[model samples]
Target: MSETMTIAPEQKAATGNSNKMLFAMVGIGLMCALLIVLTYEGTKPIIAKNKAAALEQAIFKVLPGTMTTAGYYWDGNAFSPLKGTEAEGQRVYAGFSESGTLTGFALPAVGLGYAGEIRVLYGYDPAQEALVGFYVLESKETPGLGDKIEKDPAFLANFEALSVAVGTDGNSLKNEITYAKSGEKQNAWEVDGITGATISSKAVTEALSTSTAEWVPRLYEAKERFKPQTQSHE
Candidate 1:
């Protein structure tokens, strides 16, 4: 029985196998943890600085002449956060000229494309009561089809001070936003839909409708409130 029992060399081999397994597990775990920590440390500052710079760039693009953030209200969602409210999802950034006059509204807009969500930064001129310009922030649309919304200048130019005839009923506008053929569009609210690219055109039109239909009225209200007062007593 002793002859068949585990000898010193056999016991040593078993211990070596157990030790090797334990060491390998510990080494793998340590490597994973170290990679996580290093990645976080390397990326944290870059992420924050990118966000800040993006805001600065947006402010510059939307409202040129000045580089200050003083008068800008963090209108979290096309409305002021008020005195003591918490900021939440989405932020509507308003820009002003150097003279402290309202220039336009820079809103964050998004829509679902055939592949995924499309994001944009759009500016609306309160004076003209129309869209001034827009830039695509992100999109997962098809490369040659739906992606035209971002690259086509004519498509981009379609948005201007499109007018909305409000109904007396007050729930929604009288006329919904429309896209027509080029030169056929007469109103500030009408756009020239893309030819042979109906889906892309429809996506853009629907996005504008969903975004502006709700916020434009609110902006009208805000414009009235924030309008510089002229003397009344005459």
Candidate 2:
């Protein structure tokens, strides 16, 4: 008779244990992936709500006198009430006063900073041709140096009524915002740069300049569309 082939008892046990360990590892990985997906799904709505709330607050802050706000989508032709996620092109948030009059527009702009991109929200008063308010939305700037763009009171003053008058062409800024040397601001459109944070300060100026160059004319042309609805006097 042929010798019977046999796996040693310990060998068989080791093999069984190895297979069990592999299965356990695979099971754990799948469980981890499932948990991650579940967690993302569960928290998505809350995260969205928080973001929306923050943006609303920022809109009010940047566009002073705003008691209410509405989002609009600019499709290179007109501003329309946002439908679904069609926030493509230039998105604008119109701020309205308690009396239901349109106050100003909150526009987002981003530019390169010392460390990275600096994002800002600014309020534009089409009537005044000025930037009335400003708030830093996000920045990855140097701690003490570049961060001054957000913290410096002197820098903040620049946006209180920075001029962005349309040029005679009616399609471009008469004078794009420029960073003036400390204490040398000579015009309404000049911004005084932070002494130590020139790059970051310049970034904000450039961001607004570029954004307004593209949007101001369009918005001015569509100003009537932004007016609050009034009951017919008839």
Candidate 3:
């Protein structure tokens, strides 16, 4: 071999240009990617807070009352994160009005539906001792069929003021939440079934019963848990 190798003029120029372009492209791509990640991370907390605030506003609008986070709890605990409570402990969120009265509750419950898990929110009217309203958080029911329970106005109206009367036995509803296959409703606990959606109707019934039915009594027990520090003027 010779002492040194010669570089072709055309090949040298092409190689130099290619290396510069490749490095420039890589640098631009990395900057773009970093900017995207930073933007996502920056907006994450704001998005979460907006969602939480919206949900809280919705809950208050459905259930009667004005509130401060002071009286509300998170997760499943009976009260909010008070002193000495761990920030990461079992979550519980309860709500109360300004006057220290037990107004209502926002309970999240789950039930098995014809399609899959049915998540719902039941608003209990403590004054009336009845379910004032309900909202389906989520479900996987068949469209136009089982899912109508979450949207149809007629179906939604049926649940208003539907009191789950705890019977003397204490294990059954004052009137078992049943679908009148043939007769007129004799109690609030009953409703005309979803006409053709038996499983879906029953799924709503189950979620409501498990969520509202059981929690109402427990609420009364913890009624004072959310009492505010009142220093009002006469």
Candidate 4:
């Protein structure tokens, strides 16, 4: 009954070192997480402000002659001024001229592109039943090819007065938007494709087709809600 159990000095030292390393790594990880949270909190308001400003600019860009803008959310029945932080259903912006006439509505839409998702704002004139202007809010398309959808003059021209007239039923598009090869646009609703950016061009067309199919009818019905008295916020 005489043998005493003992951990060798080297073993004891190794175990102590391992424990220290484990504790150090855990401390570092916790500190890193705390820093990340702090950073995010510190920048949250700034990020929100920048996003709002960008959206304001985009609204004006998509609706020319818009000297002021206002936001509203569609209730089941009609649009109400977006005042509180919370709301239900899709939100839209109404652009007003200096004289307070409602120029158009900026309808936000999203779609999948060649590289990733594409976000856009399209200006619709209910009076003309046409998309008067277009702006890409966000996109991750290919550099030279797909990005041409944003910059190519010929491609951009497609949205100038592009027709999206509602059908006789008043709830569907008369002619769903179409995409054609470069220089082949022959109809009012056909979007001309970029020479090398077919997918991106089609993506834009499809996005407008789907978004307008749903929104144009609703906006047309709610057109009176966007009159001069809807109230503008910031």
TM-score (C-alpha) between model 3 and the true structure: 0.65
The sequence of per-residue lDDT tens digits that candidate 4 reaches over residues 56-127 is: 899888888988888887776778777647432277888889998889899888879998888888999887
Indicate the residue-level lDDT of 152 in model 2: 96
| Cα shift from native, residue 182, model 1 (Å) | 4.3
Per-residue lDDT for 126-147 in model 2, tens only?
8888999899999999999999
Off by over 4 Å in 1: 1-31, 55-89, 142-145, 164-171, 223-234
Best candidate (score: lDDT) = 4
Residue 170, candidate 3: alpha-carbon lDDT: 52
Q: How well does candidate 4 score on lDDT at residue 53?
A: 81
Query: Worst lDDT window (10 residues) for model 4?
Result: 7-16
Give the clash count for each candidate. 5, 0, 12, 0
Error of 2 at 181 (Å): 1.2
Model 2 lDDT, full chain set: 0.84
Alpha carbon deviation, residue 136, candidate 2 (Å): 0.9
Encode model 3's per-residue lDDT on 26-123: one tens digit a residue.
99999999999999999988986787687666566556674743324344645444342444222224556776565666666677989898877667
RMSD in Å for candidate 3, one decimal? 7.8
Predicted structure with the largest TM-score when compared to the true one: 2
Ranking by lDDT: 4, 2, 3, 1
RMSD of 4: 6.0
- Candidate 4 stretches with Cα past 4 Å from truth are 1-47, 83-89, 228-234
